[model samples]
Target: MTDYQKQSPMQAIEVNNIKKSYENKYALGQPDSKEGISFSVSQGELFGIIGPDGAGKTSLFRILTTLILPDSGTASVDGLDIIKDYKEIRNRVGYMPGKFSLYPDLSVEENLKFFASVFQTTIQENYYLIKDIYQQIEPFKDRKAGALSGGMKQKLALSCALIHKPSVLFLDEPTTGVDPVSRKEFWEMLKRLKNQGITILVSTPYMDEARLCDRIALIKEGKFIGIDTPENITAGFNKTLWSVQSNKMFKLLTDLRSHPFIDSCFAFGETHHITLKNNDLTINNLCRWLQQKGHEEIIIQEIKASIEDCYMQLAQNG
Candidate 1:
């Protein structure tokens, strides 16, 4: 076949219309954990699955990492079928679950050595791959895995996952419980790994983390609401949003929700973000209405869109 006709070996991860569900007893009156989900991650790309709790990020990661099977549809890792090549795929992928799943009683060094042994390799053989991460925790090598702090545990878990030298690394909410400094450190480690050409797929509920990935898929209610570069996703927001604040935030929020011109409004940090039904709404009109309602020290200003804003908009529409 000619070069144009030949299939390109680009995608390191491929998920196509996958679906999974549990019995009602397990579901708790919710939809399936995964619903017709589909996406791909290019070779060496750091792809992110951005979603909140119970958004099916874990379920999808389980399927891709060969720990569970999808009820329908298909997925592949390193171009190998998830089902047919489950064994081979297991050897080719590294997965750090959302929760710390390492042996609690084991020391840091033991945990790393155990995982490497299970993969038929030794820490000495692949020590270079995890050297940067392992070195940080090496001083505490004798500490039991369960006794470590959140950030230390995170690094240890990541180190264990990479011991196998897998081509694609799947991290499910790796930074969920870590402190701000540790979260920042964890992403820096990911960036270094990415530079080494390891394909990384991470999922997180924190919208701020989405910007760190090369591309992100915003998942909600067991489906993708948006998928693109962080910048592009923020740019795709079509409405004019404003930051609103007042001396009485609670009262201001209630009043804003009651306004007929408000399209969507939600508390964002110290301020509330609201979009109008149309761009024709004027700040003066809102200020006048709020003033009449006894609101004081009202502050309203148009603001640039953020990933959080985009996710909120999608959740509202879908």
Candidate 2:
């Protein structure tokens, strides 16, 4: 329900009970990736896996991209079994890992050609697919990939990934270290790709980017705590929330959490977001208490729970 209509009855991707761990250091979950990791992505839907680092986003992506096998699970990409049809799956999907994996010594144009050839295709054959992105770096065709700026490198990697015109695209933390402008431009490109009927699965650590997806899965500690549209996720919050700020911002958080009427409190940028335990006290009363604690410049404003606030609450309860 990403607001994007399904173009096909067959799912672009399907996962069931996918689980993995490294020497038990990073298990997806106790059993079945915490009651089993299962989800389906409709064709042409732009789904996002939003979480911080070490949340198993990369592990999940690697399994789907055929870069590695899951310890236990069943998955299909483009209707091809991840295990039985992995070879064909590789041919039908494009993967861009968190790090730049392109050949460092090769030129930007050369890299694109090489990836296209691996799929037994040619850049010219699918030039229309990546024309907009490639044109931005076309002038740097001869520049070595390793020598290009981070933004340019990102564009090159993306162009190469799309050169084969795969049915699905997997991007893992694609904007992790890129500049803000590049990140913005990259998302615009993804929107365009989605409009062209490509199903995109992207993961990002930026909470603010959750709104860009048709739907998002909030993963924490290797498990998905919540999955839904950004609006719905926040709307599901049942508690009363407020944003409180004071001159002593750090101390304000500590004081707010210790209050009996405050159910939960967490620092959100310049303000401390809190949910009330009950209607025992009003905002004016809370401000007075803060003033008693030697706080100045008090500002308390009721606000809606954001995705981060929702994530915090869900992670705590999950």
Instruction: Return the TM-score for each candidate structure.
Output: 0.94, 0.95
Query: Residue 227 in model 2: shift from native, Å?
Result: 1.3
* TM-score (C-alpha) between model 1 and the true structure: 0.94
lDDT of 2 by residue, 79-120 (tens): 899989988998899889999999999999889989988989
lDDT of 1: 0.90
Candidate 1 on 1-318: residue-level lDDT in tens?
Answer: 233214454999988878877763221113544448888888889999998898888888888988888877888999999999999999999999999999989999999989999999999998899999999999999999999999999999999999989999999999997899999999999999999999999999999999999889998867888888888889889998999999999999899999998999999999999998986679999999999999899999999999999999998998
Best by TM-score: 2
lDDT of each: 0.90, 0.90
